[model samples]
Target: MRQEITSYLSTIKNEMYQLTKFLYDNPEESFKEKKAQDYITKLLLDKGFTVLKNYMDIPTAFHAQIGEGHPKICFICEYDGDIKKGHIYGNNLSTSISITAAISLAKVVSKISGSVIVIGTPGELNGGSKITMCKQGAFEDIDAILISKPHIYNIENPKCPAILPLKIVFEDNLSGNLTSMDAYIMTINLLCQLAKGFKPGCTIENFSISDKVCVISLKAPSFDTAAEIRHQIEILTNTLGELIGLNHEVTLAELPCAEIKTCKTLNRLFAHNLKECGIIELETDKCVTSGSTLGCISNTIPCVNSYISILKDKSIPYPSSEFAKETLSEYAQEIGLKAAQALAFTGLDLMEKQNLIIEAKSELIVQSN
Candidate 1:
């Protein structure tokens, strides 16, 4: 079955390369991925998917469905690029692999008994399309969602915690002869200490301070953990302000952790499929702690966001361009084919092995309840 799926995907090699290259060459920012959306929609439509353009009323978002009946498996794709910095985060690679995988699976969906859904979610960096999709009930009918991402290891689960993106502003005038720069530096140093004191699976990422404003991103394993961290930060900020005679102000925005309620059976099946597809090492390094749009969907439904390593070696750091290149290279095409094979096999298993999907849904119900 894996070889047959690979053969099917091999037939589309040139087209896949063209599609991947075009998207890579013309990167679009969050919420402005019109061209990317149109291209993906057309490709899926050509493969017999019922494409719903501008899905959920988001201009660049779409939901394409192929096949019919019992179990509905979803392939989540994010195409929004970092227009300013190019595909530095390798979203283009993710987007291409997802679309290619979905199409590849669609070719064999008729042989199976379930639907394959490809959801094109735009705006990972700026706009939160998955949040909107979940709120709009996009994932309500889905049985399972598969997401591919670039990472250092083949992680079935990566630590993904509830994230709080907060902006802290020191509003009061500088005390005595102190300048905003001095206050900023002092505040940052103190925050660094606070971060150092944080527990495992909690981190402060992308902390930047300028003038009287400081922006820090927080991630914790759960909502309660995040709330506790937030409270601690507030207390420490207040203490520092009082000590320096400066006023501190904080504004926070919450993002629900796409806490993956793990289904051991499904994970086992995926791991088996991945190994059969030529991947030797499988690690659960941890759950994804980084913020991902997939988190929003996973928070609402049974989803697996698999991270496949692009690096030939795990110890060395590779350039983002190399990652992008890998997504389109011949080797990448093989990886993409394997990914499709894995998802296809998983979907088939979920549809046929009633107990497996039942257990997965039971897990989601337990987590939600």
Candidate 2:
């Protein structure tokens, strides 16, 4: 079965590269991804998917559906790019195009009972389209959601936790003696310490600082930082937020981040299907947990996210273009194909009601515990 998927993927290599290159060449930020949307819709339509353009009112966001009754699954992605960098991450387009591969395999999707919808959500980097989709009564009745990211260690399974994104701003008169560096360190420490309160192993937080230079021009440097807190225990996210006097702010405090609420039934279906795909490989590294990239959809729909090994320089930090390039290697590409093909088979197992439901439930419980 995996071999057949390999062959199927091979035949359309150019299509994959061309689509990737086109998006890479024409970089769009957030909802501005009209071209990317058109390209994605056109391909899905050609392959017999009922493509819905600008799904959920998100300009570049879309949903493509194939197949009939039974279970209704989805493949969703947050595709907001740094227009300034274009394809800085190994022809950048490849990063997004990787999702297209799953789209290209519409035939396999059709084989599964029920519908398989491909959701191309925009503004993941900034806009938070997933938040919008979840709020607008999206993800209702969806059986499972899937995503394939550009990089990470290919985990047969990765831990997933409830994730919450928050923005913290420190506003006070600086006596006119505050630099961006000073502000950065101070904010990082406070945010890091606050995040630490979210229970040790299960919770994780990532932060970014925004410069509100115009507002606090002369008074004080407004160090606006965004932090995302994730935990298997849903209550922990809120408990951590409560621990910090989020309501207390010197200038302006906004709770920009919130963990996604997922559908319980769909989660079990996905877990069962994944286990059947292959022997579930446990990750050795403690930090390596549930797929952060795919977590966007898990918040709303039943989605399973995992990591594919980085092509090179795993030790390096984020925004490492060099490491991103390594992911595009020929060998890496082969591994990706194998992984995708194996995963395709996983979708088939989902057609069987009992096993699929049980597995997903087990996975959710496992992660929660």
Candidate 3:
């Protein structure tokens, strides 16, 4: 069966590259990825599968189901390419790989015996696609999810910490206060002091000035700030939380940050899975990724986010035009196929066990200062 699926993919390899070139030639943003979605749909329908256009009620978003069985599983793919001029990271290539994988999974997983869903989501750059699907109950029945990102590294252990994104304003010109600047300065000092134990698990803690100091927007004066409080450990995450909560009792302008959560599961997987995946979108080669911001790893589902790693840059393993120009060897394609192979094997194993019904839960806590 594996050989059969591989044969089917080989037959379509030229078409896959053609889709890549077409999408690369015409880049589109989220919600507007018509050409990309159309091309992918065409491929799936051609393979004796049913394609659901706009499955999540989100335009350009879809879910393709193949085979049938007890546990319904889904793999994730995003096709919206980057249009920010020079920095194009293989949206077309990854999408092509993901769709190719999906087509193979469809051909292999017998619907009469097992079920599968290929989720082509848009707007990952805006950070809301999968979450939106979850809200619509798409995840409730899903046994597991698969996703991948461009990378120079591989999946390590728990990586890409959860983050809290906050929009805050400080003002002292109201009825009771010292001054916004003074409050800001004092809060900065206290937060920094508390941030020492807050470093690793709660690895990313940064602030930036946002809007102009206009209170009229308020008449007197006020400051706009945003916080990206990111952490990996729950305890370290709460350290800053404790400080923020303690200060909130004293003044309202101490400020809060963005969607922050210390993803312990994510962090642990970061250390465990680096041998599996890497986020080349951050830095190609030189495997030792740093910083766990929501900006880094949020929508990445359950266990896979744990697999991120840093790659050795002794070779330029990026998807840039420059890298594509160097076809002097054959390892990168092999590695990419390795990703597909792993996904297939994991998915097959999941399908094999889809009928087993069991329930269990546990909590493990670790502390670091």
**The candidate that achieves the highest TM-score relative to the unseen native structure:** 1
- What candidate 3 gets wrong by more than 4 Å, as runs, is 85-89, 156-158, 171-193, 204-206, 213-331, 353-369
Per residue, candidate 3 scores C-alpha lDDT tens digits across 147-244 of 55445456433233333433334433554445555545554565555556543444324454444121100000001111222212223324433443
- Give per-residue CA lDDT, model 1, range 1-369, as digits (tens): 445566787787677667777888888888889889888888888888898888889888888888897688888787766665566556666776677777777777787688888888888867468877788898888888877676667787666667778778766663366655666678778778888888888887878876557888878877677778888888877887777777777776444444445656567788887887777588884765466656666655677777877666555344355555556566666666566567666766776676777887787678778
lDDT winner between candidates 1 and 3? 1
How many residue pairs clash (N, CA or C atoms closer than 3 angstroms) in each of the candidate models, in the order given? Answer: 9, 13, 55
Over 83-190, each residue of candidate 2 has an lDDT whose tens digit, in order, gives 775534332433333354455445565544566667776765563576567667677677666655555454433444333343344333344455444444554555
Tell me each candidate's TM-score: 0.88, 0.67, 0.64
Rank candidates, lDDT, best first.
1, 2, 3
Q: Candidate 2: how many backbone clashes?
A: 13
Give the deviation of candidate 2 from the true structure as CA RMSD.
7.9
Q: Give model 1's TM-score versus the native structure.
A: 0.88
Report lDDT per candidate: 0.73, 0.51, 0.48
Pitting candidate 1 against candidate 2, the one with the higher lDDT is 1
User: Where is the poorest 10-residue window by lDDT in model 3?
Assistant: 214-223
**How does residue 223 of candidate 1 score in lDDT?**
60
Instruction: State which candidate, 1 or 2, has the greater TM-score.
Output: 1
